[model samples]
Target: MWLLRPPGVYRPQPDTWLLVQALHDAGIPRGARVLDMCTGTGALAIAAAGVGAGHVTALDVSLRATLATRFNARVRGLPVRVERRDALTFRAARQFDVILANPPYVPSPQGDLPRSGPSRAWDAARDGRALLDPLCVNASGMLSSGGMLLIVHSAVCGVAPTVDLLHKVGLKAAVVARRTVPFGPVMNRRIPFLEEQGLITAGQRDEELVVIRGDRRDDQP
Candidate 1:
């Protein structure tokens, strides 16, 4: 799919495509309400609409990202509502039947998240859970009964922690997909820091990206 990516907007990469494939595997119900969190180029949102979602909302903290998504969706004639908002604090009026996320999970030396710039696209805090932890805790509240959340992140941040967080919130979660890819420019540059943080071994040139699936039980209120 073609996209209009402004400067600083994240270019769709492996993690994005991995999440997209996982979203397709999840099988959207016709007319299901969907939310795409941290929608970089709105790839997932457009995909959700293309797959027959009744209402699709894409949220990103970056203005360029939101505009890029709006334009991308417009050109494709997809009815995707684009919003410039922080996913961690966003609350929709109605629960979504499906939520897709490819948030920033890269371990960064910065003690806190970057408030602005391209780094925001991929830099999470030291542990790489700056967004993941909260997303897991809050996702259950955003999902309707029987809804599912599909998110992608690197195993360097620890997949079990994410699964445990989802489980704590009552979502039946597990790693549904995995792909091993060589480090990109960003990860490759962070090799020294990553090794120091114990996120990677000294000679590890590849990282495994995992797609985690969390399903809200039908019995949930």
Candidate 2:
């Protein structure tokens, strides 16, 4: 499916490549149940299906996004289930073997940015950790035993805090992959803080991609 460059919606970020590559490298088995949260254009979901995920459920808060996902899936002839629902309120009737998400980790400003497609995708509430926190906290309930959750985000948005939250919820989080890219408008002030905290280093600084893995446990928090 073609990705429409709509106003106020966040377009696909470069970090999405990181997720696709990592998942491809990880070798998800054919017919494995997978869930893609905040699936913007259904890129990751489509990739997963192409790479042999048995069933893929792509969820997003925006109806436009869901439509895009559906269109894309049809174009590729990949059978993906697209759902329009807020990630926070989405309740899975069954657990999945793999859960993937690329949420809006860029903290939103008090005033809204220009109503662009990319803006809508990137802006998040409260330092960009709002969505990440809830996802980690609720992951155990949504993932089956021994299932895994793969998430990608920037280092500037408090990666440590995200790791801590995941651990607190009984998930063993780790940085599976990372890459630096040219920082853009959505990444303005946060870069300095990330550098100060050693999350990003000097010389050619840019966005960092982090992949966190959540281990399954019956006694999860």
Candidate 3:
């Protein structure tokens, strides 16, 4: 089950792997419907199915990534539905019990991205929170009642602001888990930006993995 991953698509992050492990540890029941947003290479979705998710839907904006996911799932014999659509534009007819997303958290101005490859994964809007804010706002609608939304991003994205955005969207969010990994290609550029923004003051640049969960609630404004 090996296919060439798209260039801009971020490969699976260590934190994402940790989050999946956390979900398994928390006992995400077998046969539960799960959605993996911004799915790259179908890693999380495939892992979910392997761990007992009844069904898994993997969504990504890149056609190449989706195709890769489809091929990966087929090769592994994992039942996963891969969708090629913008995460912001795509909608699910039915809500999901478990939703996982590892979006583009790097802050980049429009048209700033490289022509293609891993660079696409690194281009988040200015302030790094641009994509994150919208994702939280729409997350409420995408989740089933009592459903959980799991997301991972860099600490340089400003953890406080990210939490604030989630709260603004009516999702009670928390940092359920975190992991620090050696800085890589994505972090190489992001680190300096974060420093200039005063997001990080001192310390070596280490990739931060944050897991935020939004729990569905009945009470609504």
The best candidate by TM-score is 1
Decoy 2 TM-score against native: 0.85
Q: Give the higher-lDDT candidate: 2 or 3.
A: 2
Candidate 3: lDDT over CA atoms?
0.77
| Candidate 3 per-residue C-alpha lDDT over 1-221 given as tens digits, one digit per residue, 9 for 90 to 100 | 24457665567668668777767765777788899988888888888888899989999878778988898888888899998878767778988888988887776545343346665665776666656777788888888777788888878777888778778878888888888887776556666666776766656667677888877786743
What lDDT score goes with residue 73 in model 1?
96
Model 3: worst 10 consecutive residues (lDDT sum):
108-117
TM-score of each: 0.98, 0.85, 0.88
With candidate 2 superimposed using the best TM-score fit, by how many Å does residue 24's alpha carbon deviate from the native?
1.2
Which residue runs does candidate 2 get wrong by more than 4 Å?
1-7, 111-118, 189-205, 217-221
As for lDDT, the candidate ahead, 1 or 2, is 1
Candidate 3 Cα misplacement greater than 4 A, ranges: 1-8, 109-117, 218-221
Among these predicted structures, which one has the highest lDDT? 1
RMSD of each: 0.7, 3.5, 2.5
Instruction: Give one digit per residue, the lDDT tens place, for model 1 in 83-202.
Output: 999987888788999999999999999989999989999999998999999899999999999999999999999999999999999999999999999999988998999999999998
Candidate 2 Cα lDDT to native: 0.78
After TM-score superposition, what is the CA distance of residue 209 in candidate 1 from its true location, in Å? 0.6
